[model samples]
Target: MWACKNEGEDARLYQAVKACSEFAISLGINIPTGKDSLSMKQKYKDGEVIAPGTVIISAAGHCDDITAVVEPVLRKSGGAIYYINLSGDRYKLGGSSFAQILNKVGTETPDILDAGQFKTTFNTLQELIKAGKVQAGHDIGSGGLITTLLELCFADRNLGASLDLSALGDQDIIETLFAENIGIVFQADASAEAILKANGVVYHQIGTVNETAQLTVKNASGNWSFDIDHLRDVWFKTSYLLDEKQSGPVKAKERFDNYKNHVLNYSFPLNFDGKKPVIDAAKPRPKAAVLREKGSNSERELANAMYLAGFDVKDVHMTDLISGRETLEDIQFIGAVGGFSNSDVLGSAKGWAGAFLYNEKAKQALTNFFKREDTLSVGVCNGCQLFVELGLINEDHEEKPKMLHNDSAKHESIFTSLTIQENNSVMLSTLAGSTLGVWVSHGEGKFHLPYAEDQYHIVSKYAYETYPANPNGSDYNTAMISDQTGRHLVMMPHIERSLFQWHWANYPEGRKDEVSPWMEAFVNAREWIEKLAK
Candidate 1:
């Protein structure tokens, strides 16, 4: 959001917001909430200057597991690479970051074609992710294809890639590499070529992931090569402090080797091998409540998932419970839906949790509800943060083991992979040792459990204890944990987001029609509730 005093600029801002809303609607997505400030000006000794009018769009949606998400990094030498053209128009360099850096602005803004084209491209890409056809993925933006490729190469310091822009047709090297266009670049096996072709997706196979320490791009004119280490040093400008050996060839190579051998080779897969029994929704089901707060955004999807899993679901709000409009007495299970309740005031979920703590009636109701032996509860994302705040996860409400800022020091939204523990909590008991891809987006998500030596049952952990895989840098790479009784589960990842196979970024091949493994958690809760009720 930006402020502008001029009416003309405000009109333009409204037009831009309208365009963005239409674009989102075209793609079947929604913009739930937004913020705006109308006046922004600075007065100096000479005069007052009105700030540039701008409309910032925050696009957020649920995605399948982060485990299967395509990172910008190149992985597996020899993997085929592709360039997907999303903009059905000519390449233009106007307003590009590259042009701005060079102090040159062009006359033409790159044309964004019909929304239908992007919709098709995105759908195809989603299928590819679900099928595990894409190993790495990146959108073409910023410095255009060139910078995107560089980011990929730098994503994993040990990896490099080689490509030929000749497949992009008779475009100039500058236009081909620097044009800020709507497109995507991804890496996959050769089999993906047939998949794209069969789906009528417009794409060009342009390169391969390689072991060489360089970014090699070839055009009709000739071949160009950039030394990986030098590029990193120049681009990062502080490699001396971050990776001190960037200037040394032998030391860099040694470090790359260690990263490849130790980190790159680590692998874990889904456990069932396509043999797990389908959830029998026809069987007797238990009643459940999907709790929500004023700012709770995930209740609909979670309630839908529960209903689909054969639970008689009710959408309950905090006001409903406190005002005697709703009761949990009839509910055998509860899903604490995730969201930025009360705009994450006082910290993540703190305001939402305070409702339970400060309201005597609601507090007594929840206490009596929790005492029921036949009940089980699951909290996700913001709900998980609330659980920690309310001492649901930690019975004694220890000062440690609190939800804190992610080590990355910023909000992170990405698909991440996690490994289910062998002796995981009850919600994930059937998925022990399985690797899952789940989406996670949060600012203060890190689980700071300083005393987590063996107190809580850890359900899932990051496959790789790194930036995005272990997004929040939780203690022991913990993604999900449970209370001592195993009846209460709190997890940071959005498992409910992947209840449907189509919602996944990648699902096992031939399992496209099946529901995701995440549904198991809900079904398990239902089963537990039924048995305890008996």
Candidate 2:
């Protein structure tokens, strides 16, 4: 594992880094690789901009087989959901996103009761997973149980869950249900109860997955049943509603109500034309280029996923191409990883796109790379934004699509659901018709497609019965798209994040023993690359 920290020069930043180092030391963690960009200040003629001192910590780890990993998706209806406590009687809402939503800021900082207890809890959970005891798991954070529990339910559209908070000894219902605390919730098989008890972990039987399509919680006040669909719309409301007008377009309650029953399947024919792949005995793997720019962050994980998918991975930096330090001459696959390149100025990835457009060397190299029929490209999040802006994603159209500010006024981060579409891009060909859970944390993610719908292939769409399942309120709930040729694909979600099961703090019970579906994206890309290589 490797850790990197970037801190703006300030007393707070210095102290925070010290505390972080102490925590890392306690965990026996080492910072082997890292980068730092200091002095985040800009001065204009009249006024100067001094941004808040901040520290961004990035970490990466080596996993033998991502296919053995789990994902946070609510599984079989009738599965048991357990909430495991790690903070020992501490459920603080200080600095919580939920508090900000309610226009309330509390002074108490959320704390870990004991680092030892946390380590024990985490290790025990891993033990259960290793023993095939845990079906799925998710750690509680941010908006608290309300967010966590709902996310579990949303993992599968077919689930309706019921929770009885009565087991949670006398406490303020609001605080108990909405406090941001250190804890994890997971589903397990009935037989795992023995192991859970032997482990001596603090836990509670909070809920049961059902088919009612409702979220029922029994509290001291009484039994409360919320229409799951309506709750979803409110849970994912586009904006912090000062009123209805800013709420944007919310799907009808009926849509949410029947979403669980809606069978979403597409039968569009695939149009891939290529000769059979011939893997040379001497060189079995094709070279895959994982591209990154200054602010690019997801490169490590994206590259990791591709490497796991059987590619000869190459780290490609935009600066290298622009300075003629490196070339994509032999690369078969090109991936633009996500990040706030150029600090998302003039819109997300706009600055990154400008570099490709203005730098003659970089531009020509990329053009030549894309012109190769065997070469394929995929862009994610900020990378997706840049591809659309540069006409890589929708070259077939005169007026291409654009990623715009989400109807949500601010950045919304969550593990959301999406379903693959038929006749999609080569990268998703094998994932068609499958539903998945992927992380989406972006402010400017909504898609503005000006061309006719048929001009491009829709790779996937949000499983939104209401507001947030659609996340960004994109047109047609579109989450990803490809160029007319299907070789170039771009998407908003972090598919690489779901490469392993543990990547999900809470995973689907039914899929607990299975690998994440997102791996198919890379698998499909590899297969495509191999075919073109022939």
Candidate 3:
């Protein structure tokens, strides 16, 4: 095992040796020890090579850096080195610093998954395997538990297994789908006693393999079984097929007319005198001035433009609804505007999500409205975060969209360019074959999804600059995404504010373009609403 000492090296080196010694003792390996050099000499004298078949754990710089040095040495001696890399003190696993990273990653800090714990586990597994203790090993990675189990089944090939997952800490289906912990692996051996004796880390035997090709899972309550072949088939199928069923060629004129009627005929009740309720005529009314709040200038402007294109607009505080004053279904369109709401506590948009989720009436109302296809919703910036939290969109599966932190680890407020993908979406059809310029301002805005086979698709994306350039590290460079139904549009940037000429970011570029392409998309939406009124 190769070790190095840099600044503050001696203490770390001593800790590493102590851990290795404990691991060795756990495996029932006896080693003569005294000073550091004395122990090294004793190991060499006891028929152990100083270079190979030895597990070298270090925190010298990059884990890969140490691996490069140790691999050759181990190979030359006809052995392998298992390198365990530590990012920081193992005890700091669930501290606030780690929680902040999780917040940035747009995921709740997992209670059971810890990086340091997994690193220790990996090192132990490797040591056990090297000592001829385990027959096979598997690493835990993306797709969380589901992917891990599937890979294990593939590796075993023809050998089925039953898992008693009662010992696992997390039981939530969604949590099991996306939890990511590095360096953890599962291994098995023929001789259970020998494997136990060689164990250098903590592990539990959940179950054993059998002759069948079925993967059976047993919880505290009962058993569930699935065929590996069937699982693999479903797992590999493309998700794009969900939108494969064509709605036939869309009659842009006819559909627009229908949308206009749908909006105009939709009756909305309003409490105008602050007491008595009255029915408001649903018509292609001019977009009303939006009530101002922090970061709402853009949304208000967009709503006003939509009014110009002909649509009713209103501004209601999210908190006002919580007072049992009005229901979401009462409104024709719910505009979730941008800005840091509730101080972005418990994760961005978490407060809004919590409010919605806890309100049974509101949840059912939104669900029924969508089921009836009567309501249109738009989420921008912080609003986008709320949509994911409320589960209004991205409901194809149990997975929820997570808005990860920016790669720069800072809030970037600037104007970026985006392009719309041509697809069979009512929303995307308006912006087909066109590029859009919009303003983006947020920290936790990066998007990530599990690496599942055919589970998701990127409908539209932002260009790096004005062409195909990507500014943020968004998945597929996605600036805007929609659900399969195309009823909900969630965008990270603020298009509403970019409606006016003065708000254009390229104003100083000497560009002759007055209104941004994004404003055009909003215009298209208004035109669609107008046609619906007819």
CA-only RMSD, every prediction = 8.4, 10.1, 24.7
Question: Please, what are the lDDT tens digits per residue for candidate 3 over residues 83-137?
Answer: 1212212212222333344764342333333344545555555555555444444
Model 3: per-residue Cα lDDT at residue 490? 81
* lDDT tens per residue, model 1, 1-534: 556656577778878888888888988888888888877877899997877666677666687775556667777643688998788778898888868989987888776678887887788888878888787888988889898888888745556887988979877888888888989998887887777787678888898888777989998888899887667656754533344343245333333333322232222344533233445756766788988898887788889778876788898899988897876888878888787899987898999889999987778778877887777888889988987888877776456378998765667677666878865466788888777777788888899886745876788887777554676778888888887778888888898886665565544433434566777777777777777767
Q: Against the true structure, whose lDDT is highest?
A: 1
Any runs in candidate 2 off by more than 4 Å, and if so which? 1-282, 504-508, 512-514
Count the clashes in each prediction: 13, 12, 16
| Predicted model with the maximum TM-score | 1
Per-prediction TM-score: 0.65, 0.60, 0.43
- Per-residue alpha-carbon lDDT of candidate 2 for residues 1-534, written as tens digits (9 for 90 to 100): 112132434556667768777777766677676556555667799986666555566778766545445456566743588887677756677777868888977877576666666776777777777766666677888778877887776645556778988777667777777888778888877766676678676778888888766788887777777676666667644433432344333423433344344433322224321122333558688789998888888999999888877788999889889998777998888899888898887788889998899999899899999888888899999889988888887676778788898875556577767788886588787768767667888888998987666766888988764455565778778999888788888999999887666665444433433346566667788877667657
By summed lDDT, the worst window of 10 consecutive residues in model 3 runs over 68-77
